[model samples]
Every structure is written in structure tokens, then in C-alpha cells.
Target: MTATKRCIRAEDLYQIRYTSDPQLSPNGKSVAFVETMIDEQRQYRNHLVLQSLDSKDLTSLTVGAVRDTFPRWSPDGATISFVSNRSGTPQIWLIDAKGGEARQLTRCKTGVSNPIWSPDGKHIVFSSMLSPEDSFSDVEGESKKEVQKVIVVNRMKYKSDDHGYIYDKSKQIAIVNVESGEMRAISEGPYNHTVGAWSPDGEWLAITANRAENPDKQHSIDVYLVPFSGGEWKKVTKSKGTFFFPTWSPDGKKLALIGSESDTHLHAAQKRVWVYNLENDEQTCITAEWDVQVGDSTIGDVRSPGHPNPGAVWREDGKGMYFIASERGNSGIYHTTLDGQITQIVGGSRNVYGFSLHEKAQKLIMVVSDTASPGDLVEVDLDTKEEQRLTDVNHDLFAELELPAVEEIEFEAEDGWKLHGWLMKPVGYQQGQKYPMVLQIHGGPHSMYGNTYFHEFQVLAAKGYAVLYTNPRGSFGYGERFVQACCGDYGGNDYLDLMSAVKYACNHFDFVDETRLGVTGGSYGGLMTNWIVGQSNQFKAAVTDRSICNWLSFYGVSDIGYYFTAEEIMANPFNNPEKMWHHSPLRLAANIETPLLIMHGEQDHRCPIEQAEQLYIALRYHDKAPVSFIRFPGASHELSRSGDPQQRVLRLEYTADWFESYLLTAEKASV
Candidate 1:
């Protein structure tokens, strides 16, 4: 242990800054990125920053506590376009590359996002909300009213955790002139649209949308080409699965996209890169044979919102494309040819969450994070394979703290399936001494916990608790079979994988005290926690956040419940009532004997607060062990990740307090 270093606290989250959305200039001399920090008001303040590659000098482009993000350099590198709420709504704003006052470019009432420059830099295209009967001109003249409104529900997917009340609003593509600020909706529809990339000749814009019958009922989004002059869209992709991030090749002969070929399994389907030849109207999966999942699947709390996706970037010569993929415990940059020949460009024990490549200059700038650091921009030379750190946003905060080192663990499940995980020892550790340990499970059961910085896990380690986090069988970063193993099985083999992990850790690590064990997780992880406490009494304390207690209620309550329930569980409440009830943790609530802390977001539409309420009520009615409940008023499913800053801190504080109260004695906790 160091003399000057101290243990991290929950409030240290405010001191941790994050960097994301790195955009390389066309000239490859400087990079434009977004730096986000928590202000005194507990609100996120995101500002665009320009860093010179030659001198490593940084200059802030936008000012104040307002959010200014998604900075995209113009085709000529003379101006940068970004989205900002300075005008009270997230609208497109433009500033010169050299520096100056940023001017508002759009005044859309509903706001716009994902702005991209045209090939000639004369116009910009973005996505904005538009009702079925409203046009761009109507949106500009519209003003919101605060009076009471009537409620109408006609669709299955009517509410969303991120955006509530998806009634008649649809995300449509809109275009605006840079010089005149004249804008209008280019694609109008009842279905939502996502802007991709503009064709090299500036005649068509590629987008992803589901215009099929009953679009919301199925997970089918295909790539389509919309004319710049406005008309009917040309469907380019065969409607076989979900597709997104359509990028045009340098020569405009092909389009590189990142998506999947099957939508049945949804999250279990590995995101693959496919190239659509514009000449032949044929699509081919470039990474079909590669087992690794494409895109950044690593989960973390410090990641800034709206981090730009590093979609498939075509090489300058148009022979291959570069993209990011998750494998083992790292998200690395990879390149693949048209025939599925893949090559690893840069890989390590770190998470490359965001990236931008300058094909002509062979320069790659990526936002990389490890176990100790939040994230920073790193420049890599394609030819030389050299790397250089461009920013250190959290260096000072981390320098004064003794961050724990993470040890990767590879063990076998009870079923002989291999599993991956990481163990972080408590700060200021001493040999031959036993310490309480906390088994931290990740959400998504489909989302992987890789070599990324997690504030919650670090805080627990600082409080003298060894942290054990794992990517069980249901987690990503593994193959298709492993990821799909937990689906339809729920608390079956997935529960065994977690229990086997705890057994493996206890037997292998002598310092871990198996008697004083604690468990906590959120979302699907929360469901597992509830399931564990009901099935076993091995854990002394357990905290479940945003959990699902009853599958019957979750199917109709959650935003994506209608489809997510049928796909993941392979059963519905009406058709298979016995199966759904049999797998619900609430059904076995009477078996829980451990001290349980129930926490959930009041506005969490994903799991809904009622789920937490049901478990708490059931536990109290049965008088089984000790149970407590906490609720955040304005928080949602992302409470631990991107919820209110104050509430996020409180969630961690309550979690640690609950575990410490149950697992540690006063004398040991004081030590």
C-alpha cells in the first residue's frame, strides 16, 4: 500500500471525467472529441474539444454547463457540426475549425441527432421526431403545451424506457442547408428512421428502417437508400434480420454495414459486418465465419452518452474494411476482406469503445479504457502499428487513489462449459488474512463485463471487499451457443455457472472468506440475485436492482416486454402460464433466508418498479429474513449507469451499506 494514496469513495464519481466520440479531421492533423464531466448541479456537461496531434494541445470549442456533443468535421475540415442544447433543445450547431462562436444551424422543435456532413459540405442530414401527419415545416412552427392531454394506446410498443409514450411519433430523416439554414424532412413515415451515410456522389443517403407490415411486432430493420431529392426509398437489404450503421465505400460501389442475419434470438445474435454491392444489389457477410461478436459489447458506467459507433470504415483502396469486435475480455480493432478474411489490427486487454479512422492518412484514433482508467483518446498508426495516448482526463484523480489490480479467471461451468471472469482484491491487502468478498454480476446476462473501468466495483474494493465479476454462459464475448445457452433456461444452467464461479473463487483464492459472502446485481443480474437468495443460503447479503419478480407481469409491463419475453424466455404468460410462473423468482420468495436489499428506479419501464414492490411485499408477508426497499423518483433502468448523478451515488452508498451491515462486524468494518 502507498503512503499518500487513499481508497476511492462513492462520491469520487463526480471527479471522474469521460471522453468519447473521437472524430478525425479529413487532413488528419487534429481530432475533435467530446469530453463530459459532472457539474456542481449534478448534471452532465458535455463540450467539444479539439486536440492537435502534433503538439498535443487541447482547445475547448463550446462553453458553459450546457451539453455540446457529436462533433463531426466537415468534408473539407473547415468547420465542425455538433448537437447542443444551448438553444434549449438539442439542435445542430456549427463552429469553425480554427475557433469562434458556435452558431445554431437548426431550430427543430423536437431536436435532431446523428448529424453528418454531405460530400460537398453544402448541407447536413440528421434524424428528428415527426408525427405521422406532421412535416418538417410543421415541426419548426410547433410549440409544446403543458396543458392536460388525452391518453390513447393502440400499439403494443407504446412506451420506451429512454423515450416514453412512443404513440404516434416516429424518427424521420431531415436535411438542412448549411449556408441558408433551410431545412425540411426528406423521409416521412409512420416508422422510425436512422441516418447512415451519404453516397459519394451525393445523390442518395443510406438509412435503416422497418417499413414492413406491423413493424413494431417483429425485430426487422433493413437498409434502404433514400434519394437526396426526396421520393420513394429503394430497399437494398433482404429483410432477414436487424441491420444498422450503413457506411458507404470510398468508391461508392459497395456499402459496409454492421448487423445480423437472424432476429430470432435478438441479443444473442452476433453483430456481423456485411457488404452490399450497389452494382449487383447483392449482400455478403464479411465476417460470417468469425465467431467473435462485432461492435463494442463491453459494459461500463463511465461511458458518455451518444458515443459514436465505429461502423465499418472502408479502406482507401476499397479492398477491405476496418471495424471493432469483442472477443475474450477485450474489444479490439479488426479488418476484414470482402471474402471473410479477417486480420487483427490492434488488440489488447482494454476496451476500444469508440473509434474513427482516416483511411487516406492511415491514422486511427480510438477511445480506450482499462480496469483503472475511465477512457482516453489514443492514436494508432496503421502501417507502423504504433500507439500514442492523446488524452488523460482522469489521471489526477486516479494518481491519488490506490486502484486495485484485476486478475482474469477462466474456469469451467458445472456443465463443462468454459467461463471467463475477473477478481479485484481489496485495497491495502495483506497476505494470510481473510477478507469478505462480494460477487458482482453484470446485467444483460447478454452484455459482457470486460477489461473496462467500473466505478461501483472499485468503490466496493475500497471498502475492504474483494470484488468478483464474471461473464457467465449467457454473456456476450463468447460464441453464439454460449450466449444462447441461458435463453429459455433462465435460472437453469446460468444459475449453476454463477454458483460454480463462487466455488471456484473460494477454492482458488485463499484470502477470500467464503463465510462472509455478498451478492448484488442489476437488471437480469438482479433477477439472478433474487433467484440465488431463494434457491441457496450461501450469501449473507444480497441486493437486487431493477429486477423482474414475475414473468407474467413483466411481459405486459416492460417496454420491450411484448417481444423480449417471448424471445428470451421462450414462453408467454397466456400460452404457457405454468412455465412462466415456474421460472419467476417471486414464486419462490418464501425460500429466501438472506438479508435482501431491494432497489429500483421509479420510472424504470424496463423492469418497472412494481417488480421490486412485488418481491418486497412477498418477502415481508412471509417474514423471511430481513428485507428493505429503496426507490429513486426520476431514475430509470440506467440508474447505475446514466441516471441522476446524486441518485447514482446514493445507489452505490446504499448497496455498500447493505452488504457491510450484513457481512461485516463493527470491529472488522472499522478496521
Candidate 2:
């Protein structure tokens, strides 16, 4: 008799380790990265970890209760600098590569982030939120005393999902003395400045900012070169499209940027790669005809929502570039020439979350993940295209956990739209037995369900349910045409495409029990769940999470409502009330026949908790369908991925119980 392996539990996610920001040392023998985990107290604890290729051993540089992240090796490779909240406020901290006590380098009043060491390694450039103290040397206590508590807001983009209110302070670029720990503001103005790559000569720092007189109204943000010695900044690109993540060439004569022409199209715009020449001030699109979007656009619920793409890196000779892009569900590294000739470097059905390149060594360090693995660091050979596992952070836990096997498949929609998706089989199965199917929809509608590890899906499959997730019309990674196909067309072909995926699965896979089917999703996916249930009663149960029910009201409550409302639906609530109501799921709430469960976060500013409340009220008031609503207290829009540990576990447990209760007759509720 064979002993049964332990199945993955919902609570097992807390023990999983997440890795990011891999930095290759100058000598390319050592790599410094960030390792984060959730503690019992429900707080994120970050540690600076180092690994050596020669010794094949791991070392923790800074480990404690506080958060430390964004480890970057200096040019000399003697010391590593990172951002930490050890002193109650986030500031730049530095420690020797040989290992010792870390010393705080910056004492910014508003806090500092995104630290980049100068080429000479004598100074570090970072972005920090500023205050009007008349001096940059004000200490913490004195700085707070100078500012008033009351905040007056007057900007259209006053609040964001990550930041509740960003009216009082704006981010400014500054430089810090490495040895003396002294800092001075470099670029301080009414607008914010985002740090990009530093020029090779250390004279100019590339920055992306909308310096237009009225930045909030315009979506145009161009890359500019700011002087390190402090002076007026010069714009390098003149484009109507929005631009970001500018990377300077090794020779500092050119810059590679990521942008698109769909500022009004919201996230539906296809991100294109462009090269900007500083000498002639000429900007040319490199990937305009490539059809594929640039940068890592794959979406996953396993990691943090706001993952920053460091942009394209110039080759050692400054003739080509290496970047990561989401293509056909896989986020992999690719190479492109100055004339737009593209080639795949490390392409496959695996997710490359973050990468760091050592130009001198011709080696790349990346954080890789897949359906079976959350994340691990790996070393990649640029010339050979060979990958060697460097760190097996989750190997122990993964070995003991029984996860379902995932298989990718392709099918055509009713309108002949070719799409790709993955189906995860049940953990343990009999030859002739059929299992209930759970169809999952992704949140961003813009974000694709790619080749990434998702703990929630694993727990559902471990409970004897087959899972089906697809990238509908609006998801990224397919191409510009496919991604922009769903703009101003929500609840239309996209809805039918989802149903087609289920139909394809039921017909193609004999193990899928179509009679016992359920559908669920969060954010835009949640909106679809509400729409799916109302539009069709084919599924026995449905769960909508952090979803938008009434678009008419969502326009006023959501953080991105003002512009996103018009960008997505093509009109504001006041201008097209009838169209907005017609698109809202609440309008068709009475037609919902399937059992519905509403889930949301109380502090979710993106979709807002009011969305769930409205849907619950509409469903409950009429008593049309058996409905339940679960609200995670103090949880934000990212509850399922990076929310409170206990809360996240509870959410998965609740989701599994909900599906089991409806899918199987003899299923017992898990507490």
C-alpha cells in the first residue's frame, strides 16, 4: 500500500516564501535579493538575503521584524543599499557586502524609496516624498511640527489604490552622500518625479514625469534627463503617448522606454518599446510593428499587485536590449535590436517575475515561478540560454504538498477569436470518475491569467475540483489587437468568450462534470461573475469578489473613477446613465438564478466595499436567489494575494467550502 501525500491546505500559504529584486554583484559571483514572508501577527517581514554561486549557500544580510527591500549592489560592489522601515519610517540603509550591521543613510521627512547608487558609488540617488520645511535637513520630530495636520486637496487624482491620499506630499528626486549620510533635494517642483536609470557618466539621471502645467488632466508623461549637479532638466522625448521606465544606454547616448498610444484606452493600450536619442532629441518606436507588447504584462494573484518593471536593459555594447515580456501566458526574457528585430532569450510557459543582469559576466539573475511553484531565484546564461536553479526557497514545502497538474489548451470563440487558457486537474483521481468544474475569471480584465503559481487555485483543486481559467478578449500578452478588443465592449463578446471556454473544456475533457459547474472571479472578474449569473443560469453557483455591480455608482466611489470610468465605458455616469445602467450587473439582478456569494474587502478603494453592499442588497431585497456576502475587515483590494495572513487563509477556506458545498452532495463544510 502506498502512503498518501499531504494535500495543500489554505493555511499553507503563510509558510510560502516570496523572492524579488535579484541584484547581481559586480563580480557576478554573488546575488542579493529580498525575501518576504507573513508572520503570525499578520505583518509582512522582509529580509535582505544573499547567495553565492561559488559556495551555493544562502546568507541573510539584514533580518528582523521590520521591512527591508530593493537591494542594489553599488558599482564597486563593496556595499549594498536598500530601503527599510526599521526606524518607523522608510529610509535608505546600507551594509557592507561582507556582512555587518546596516547603517541608516537617509532621514527624509516624508520617507524615501527606489534607491539607485551612483556609478562612482560615492553617492546614492533616491526618490522621497517631501514637505515644505524650507530646509531638507529637518529631522523627523521637527519636520512633523512644521506641517499642519489638516490637508487640503484640489487634484483630480488625489487618491490611489496603493496610497489612500497623496494630496499633501509629492515625490521628488534627491541625492545622498554615501559616507556622510547627508542628502539634498535635486528636482523639487509642483509635480512628482519618478527615478529611472542613471547615466553612465553619473551626470544625468533619467526621470519620467508629467511636467505639463496640468498633469492630472493629461496622460502624457515623457522621460526627461535631470542633472545630478542640480539644474534644469531637459526633455528627451516628444510623444503624445504616455511613457515610463526609461533606461539609459551604456554609452548614455540613447534611452529605451515603454509606452503606448492609448492614454484614454486605460490599461487596454498595448505597451510598445521605444528608443529615444538624446543627441538629436528623436524618439522612434522600436516595437510598433512587432504586434507583441513589451515588458512583463502577465498578471497573477500570488505576488503583490504593484510589481514594477525595471524596463529594458542595454547590452554591454549598447547595440541591443534585453527585456521581459508576457507572451502566450509566459513572462520570459527577450532580446531586441536597435532596429526592432526581436529574438527570444528564455521563452517558455514559466513566469519570470524580476530579473537582474550583470553585463560584464553575461549572466542574468531572475525570480521564476510557475503553476507548481510560487517563486525561486535562478541564474540565466545570456549566451547559452541555460537556466540553473540558484535558490529552492519553497522546495521543502512544495515536496510535501500535493498540487494539481496544469495543462494548457487553445480554443476559438464563437466569433473565431483564438484564445489560450489552462486547466488544472484534481490532485488524486480515478480513471473513470468525473469531478465538478470551477471556472475562474481574472480581475484586471486587463491582467491575464498567466503561467504563475496561484495558492487559491491549488487549494480548490486539492479538494477534488477541476479548475478552468482563461484569458478573455481584454487580457494582455496576446497582442495589441486582442488586448484592445474589449475596450468599450464589456459584457459583450468577453462574456461569451468565457462561456465558450467552459463549453470547450466540458466537451474536450471527459473528466469535467458539466452538471456541477461554478463560476467565480474578483474585481473585473467579479463584475463578470455577477453578469454571468444574471445572464445565464447554467452554473449551479457563483462567487463575485470586490466586483463592480453598479457602474453608475462605481464611477463616483472608485479611486480611478474620474478618468477610468470614461476610458472603460466610453462615457461618464451623468452623460450615459442608461448605458451605464444597462452594463451594470445590478440592473439584471432579478434575472440571477444561480446561488450567489459576494466577497469584498472593506477597505478596497479600487472597487470599494459599496459595490458588494449594493449587489447584496439587490439580491437580498428581491429574494430572487440564495445569496451570501463576506466582507474582509481592514483588507484592501489585494486581500486574496497579499492581505492579512489569517484573513487570506480564511478567504481560501471560505471559497473552498462554498464550492464544495454546492458541487458535491456529501461534501462537509471546512471550518
Best by lDDT: 1
Candidate 2 wrongly placed segments (more than 4 Å): 1-4, 131-138, 141-151, 666-671
CA RMSD of each candidate after superposition: 1.4, 2.3
Clashes of 2: 0
lDDT by residue for model 1 (1-671), tens: 79999999999999889899999999999999999999988898999999999899999998787999899999999999999998888889999999999988998877889999999999999998766755565444466555447867777777788786677788998889999988877776678889999999999999999887787786788999999987888998877888999999889989999988886877788889999998998898878888889998889988854467869988888999889999887999999988899999989999999898987787999999999989999999988999999999988888999988789999999889999899999998888998899998888878889999999999999998999999988888988888888888999999999999999999999999999999999999999999999999999999999999899999999998878888889899888988888889999999999999999999999999999999999999999799999999988898999899999999999999998898877537668
Each model's lDDT:
0.89, 0.84
Q: TM-scores of all models?
A: 0.98, 0.96
How many angstroms is residue 647 displaced in model 2 relative to the true structure, after the best TM-score fit?
1.1
Colliding pairs, model 2: none
Clashing pairs in 1: none
Task: Give the lowest summed-lDDT range of ten residues in model 2.
Answer: 138-147
